[model samples]
Structure formats: C-alpha cells, structure tokens
Target: MTVTEVLRRFNRTYTQRIGVLEESFLGTGRPLAVSRLLFEIGSAGAVGVRELRELLDLDSGHLSRMLRRLEDDGLVATTVDGADRRRRLVSLTTAGQQAYDDLERRSDERASSLMAPLTPRQQERLADALATADLLVRAATVRLRQVGDDDPVAREATRRYVAELDDRFPAGFDPGPLAPEPDATWVVATSDGRPVAHGGLRPVPGRDDTAEIKRMWVDAGWRGAGLGTRMLRHLESLAREQGYRRVVLDTNGTLTGAIEMYERAGYARIDRYNDNPYAEAFFEKELSSAS
Candidate 1:
C-alpha cells in the first residue's frame, strides 16, 4: 500500500482507541469537556483560569461558565492571580479534592473492568498497542509554526538536532543555522505549546529556486513516532508553497532512519550539494507545479 494508505489505516485505529479512553471513561451525564477540565484542574491542585483556557483551547465565556459550575457544585473556587489581579485562578475546594480522587478511582476501575475479559498476554499486547497509539496520535497533534531559527523553541530544536547529529558524525557537525541565507523558512513543531521537533529549508545561495532542508530534529520520546517524516513533508510543502519546485538535503551516513525516511518519501539520490564537513549522503525531490 501507499504511504498515505498506511497512515490512514493507522489513523482510523488511532481515533477509535482515543474514543475508547478519553470519551468512554466519562460516566453518564458528564461530557468529555467537563471531565477533562476536572482532570487538569485536579492534577494541578490549582490552575489559573486563563492558563486552563489556553491549554484547553476553550473560549473565554465557556471556560468561565465551566469554572462557575464547578464552583456551584462545591468542586472548585477561583481567586485573582497573585501577581495579576485581573487573572482568575481556579482551585479545587477541600470537598472537590475528595471528589477528584473518586473520579480517578472510578476511571481506573472502569479501565480494569474493560481489560478483565482479556488473557494476561492479550492484556499486555493491548497495553503496548495503547501506548504506541498514544505516542503516534499525540505526535500528529503537534502543530508546525513558521518562524526564526533563533526563536527559543526553534533554537532548542536545532540544538537537539545538532546534538543527535554530533553523536552520529565522528568528524562532528556544523551547529549553525542552514549556513545563513536570505531565503529560508524555519518550522518548529510543538506539543502542549512546547517545542519538540523542528526543520528548515533555505534557498541554495547561488541557485535559482533550489533550496536545502536542514536542522531536522525530534525529541527522544518522539523519535519513532513518525515525526521526522512529518517534519520532512512539512518542509517540502513549505518549499512548494514558496514557489520552489524542489527541496534538497544532505545527511551523515550514520543516521539510518532519516536516510530511510527520505528514500521512502521519494527523495532521489543526488551528488554532494555542499562540503559541510559532516555530510555523507545528499538527496532532492522535485515538486509538481500544481502542488
């Protein structure tokens, strides 16, 4: 099957698994929204209303109403932010703390009940699949933003990427941003509003519309979650969006997974594009004008 077909098949199984845990866990009369709020607030002990809203992506009025209802039910209380009075912070009341524990206990019981029918081996397999699904889906949820490479998240991603390369390249690697060109777009991927991966595509200094992808990186936990491929696709799409017809990149021989990804993603072998002390393999992909 094609790459798209494989991804689609996994995604369907993915959403079904998420529905089972995140949606089915809420007992009758409780929607996922309220339960999620309670879980977050419960975990934090106390959280700023604004922070919750931002984290949950809930609108102002809606978040306020949820906190108000939690308050009415004696589950939570809100106070002005210590440093910023205008900001309202929400915390569980003593009663709410007890209730939160109950919620957790019941949720655990339900999970256990669901797993009871399976044999020990089946249960183990299920657990592993669930863990893999969580990581894959969580990774797909990260958004890529176009920004400057020196930006904090971007820099962190670059640093991590170079560190990984340094480990692979016996001769060491260049830690600088894409050799600095006027035409480059830096894209960083973030989960929970924190950077976890990044890459860049900059026009080859003297070439017309030909650019190179660089500074690719993904966090340790997210390494095998298909993020590197996604980041590569994201950079290719970005290059195409900027009217380029092709994207080029170079890599050291030691990073096998990255090499495989580029090969599988349709990047054809090319000769050395730069003598950046660490490069061992070079590849490029042509884009259709319609892209």
Candidate 2:
C-alpha cells in the first residue's frame, strides 16, 4: 500500500481502539470533545474562554454551546473579568473536578489495558515511536507564510531569535530592526497563530545572484522537532523564487545543532563572506530552480 494509505489505515484502527468514536469517552457520560475540554480546564485551574477556544481550535459558536451545556450540567462556570467585562473566564466546578478526576483514572486504565499484552521492551518501543510520531505531526501542522519584516509576528520572531543568540553566544549579539529592501523576504512559521519559527533571505552584498539567510530560529520548546531544518528549506525556496542561485548563512560555533542541520541539508562550509562580528562559521549552498 502507498504510505498515505498505510497512514490512513493506522489512523482508523488507532481511533477505534482508543474509543474515540464512542458517544461517551472514558465512561464520563460526555462526548470526547466535552471530556477533553474539561480536562484542559481542570488542569489549568482556570482559563480565558478566548484562550481555550484558540487552544482547542474550536469555533466560537461551538465552544459557547459546549460551555453552556457544561454550565447547565453544573460542571463548569463562567465569569466576566471586572477589569475587562468582555473577557470571559471559565473554571470547573467541584462536580466538574470530580468528573475530571474520574476521566483521568479511566483514561489511565484504558492505556494500561492497551499495554498489558505487550512485553516491557515492546512497550518501550511503542512509547518511543508514539513520541516521535507526535512531534512529527505537530511540526507538520505549523504553517509558514511570508510576511513583511515590520509585521508584528515577524518582528516578534526576530526579537526572540536575537535574544536567544545573545544568551547562547559568548559575545552578546544584538541586531538592528529589519529594514525593507528589494528582493528581501521574511517568513514566519506559526503554530496555532503563535510564531514558533522564523527565517529570512536578503540579497548578498555585491552579489546579485546570491542571498543570505538570516535570523533562522525555532522556539526553544520546538527545537528538536526538525523545525529548524524545515525553516531552512523554506528560506531556500524563497531565495530561489526571488531568482537567487546561491544562499549563504553564518552562525556561531556554539550552535552545533544548527550547524549539523545545515550540513545535513547540503550546505557546505565556506570561508566567511560577511564581516558580522557574531558569525564564527559560514556555509553556502547552491539553489536548484525546482526548489
């Protein structure tokens, strides 16, 4: 079978085995969605309604209906903030906390049952594979888009990137605000509307056919998920689209992970081409038209 077919088959079996199709989940007498929402609120103590909606990627209308149902059942309560009446906060009631505890216990029981038949080694393997799969799926869901350098999200990403560099490099790094220039492009990778990775390309000084990759960074929480490599490839594609034949980047030697990723992505070590004080290693790659 094709890879897509195999993935779809696994997904179907996994969902069914996990009782995701059940009308009630974990025997909580509520649908999976409601149970999941309750779990989030219980874990967080209290959460803003808008934040919950964003976290769950639920439509406002759907979320409101769910909250109303929970409120009617005396499982949840909502209140408006005195400082901001428009902002609604949600919290689980005492009964809701009990229900959440029950759901957690039942969920643990279900997971234990699933693993009971497996040997210890097999269980370890399954856990490792699941972790890898989860990270890969989360990375795949990140959306990359080109944005103006001055865009708030893009600016925020660059600021974080610089801050991280300052912390990591022996000599602190500080960069000026990104200025608009021809053939320059900045891209941000966002997960759930929050910037998680960013990179940019700009024309190389005195070289019309070359671009320099700058400010490539992934959030610390997201670093090991292959997001940096993905962002690098995206920057290369953007450079190609802008008619550049080559791309170069410089990095501090302390960033071994980034250097390794660049090497793996076909970037070759090169002599320093720029006078940036923070750069200790330089690399370059020839871009293909197909990108």
Candidate 3:
C-alpha cells in the first residue's frame, strides 16, 4: 500500500486503540477534547483564553462552548484577567484539580495496561517509534511563509541562528556581513506561531539567474525532524518564483548535518562563491523553472 494509505490506517487503529473515539476518555466522563482542555489548564495552573485557543488550534466559538460547559460543571473557573480586562483567564476549580489528578493516574494506568502484554524489548521499541512519530507529526504541522528581513519574527530568528553558529564554529560567527539585501526574501517556519526555522534568498552578485540562500538555521529542538530540508525546499520554490534558475549556499565545515542535508538534496560542492570569512564550504543546485 502507499505510504499515505498506511499512515491513515495506522492513525485509525491508533486512535481507536487509545480510546480517543469514546465519549468518556480515561473514565473522566468528558469527551476527548474536554479532557485535553482540562489537562492543559491544570498543567498551566491558569491560561488565557486566547492562548488556550491557539495552543489547541480550536475555533473561538467552540472553545467558548467547552469552557462554558466546564464552568457549569464547576470543574473550571473563568475570570477577566486582572492584567488585561479584555482577556479571560481559565483555571481549574477545586473539583477540577481533583479531576485532573484522577485523569493523570488513570492515564498512567492505561499506558501500563497497553504495555503489559508486550515484552520489555517490544515496549522499548514502541516507545522509540512513538517518539519518532511525535516529532515527525509536529514537524509536518510547522508553517512556512515569506517575510521581509526587518520583520520582528524574522530578525529574532536571525539573531538566534547567529548565536547558535557562534557557539558551534571554532572561529565564531558574525552577523555583520551576513545581513540580507533589501530585495531579499526571508522565510520563517513557525510552529504554534513561534519561529523554529528561518532562511533567506537573495540575488547572487553579478549572476542574473542565481540566488544565494542565507541564514539557514533550525532551532536545536527541531533540527533532526526534516525541518531543514523543508526550509531548503521552500527557499528553492521562492527562488524559482523570483525567476532564478539556480540556488547557492555556504556553510561552516563544522555544520556537518547541514552539509549532509545539502548533498542529499542534490546540491553539488563548488568553489568559494563569496568572501564571507566564516564560510568553509559552498554548494549549488540547479532548479527547474517549474519548481
């Protein structure tokens, strides 16, 4: 079967196996969504309604309804935030706290039950597979969009990228000479509205059909999840949209992961293309017009 079909099949079975489709989750007498909301609020102590909505990717109206239900049940309390009268804050009530503790205990018991039938080695394999799946799923949900270099999120991402490079490169890295040009296009990848990866494409000096990819970095937490490849592909697409037929990039030799990624993505090693003192390796890729 195709990978997509297999993924769907696994998702169906996994959700069913985990009791996610049941009206009562973990014996909480609440639907899966409500239980999850309670867990989030309980863990956070208190959370702003807007923040909660964003965290859960919930519709404002639907979230309001759920909060109302919880409030009516005396399991949650909502108050106008003291610091921000326009915003509402949600926190667990005494009963809600008790419920949260119960949910946690029951959740652990359910996990133990699931693992009971498996051998120790099989349990370890399952844990490792679940971790991998979680990372890949989170990575897939990250959003990539183009923005100007001066955008706050873009600038923040660039600063973090430079800081990381400085820590990794033996000679230390500097951002003074790496600022993107005025006409450059910058892309940032965000998960839950927080930037996790950033890169840019600028016209190569004296090369009409070539674009230089710059400031490519992925947050350390997100590095091994294929986000770097996704960012590279995005930059290539942007370059093609801007009428460039080739893309080039430079990186420090210390960044072996980046070098390997470039090679895997069909970038060929080339002679030094720029005078950046920090760059030790250069690579280039030809892009199809339709890319």
Best by lDDT: 3
Q: What is the alpha-carbon lDDT for the whole of candidate 3?
A: 0.90
Give stretches of model 3 more than 4 Å off. Answer: 45-48, 74-95, 148-156, 174-182, 192-194, 205-208
Task: Compute each candidate's TM-score over C-alphas.
Answer: 0.71, 0.79, 0.82
Worst 10 residues of 2 by lDDT: 175-184
Q: Of the candidates shown, which would achieve the greatest TM-score relative to the real structure?
A: 3
Per-residue alpha-carbon lDDT of model 1 for 27-132, expressed as tens digits?
Answer: 5234557767888899987787767875787899998887777788888888888898987888889988887887788778767877899999999999998788
Clashes of 2: 0
Clashing pairs in 1: none
Itemize residue pairs with steric clashes in candidate 2: none
Clash pairs, candidate 3, are none
Clashes of each: 0, 0, 0
- Quote model 2's TM-score: 0.79
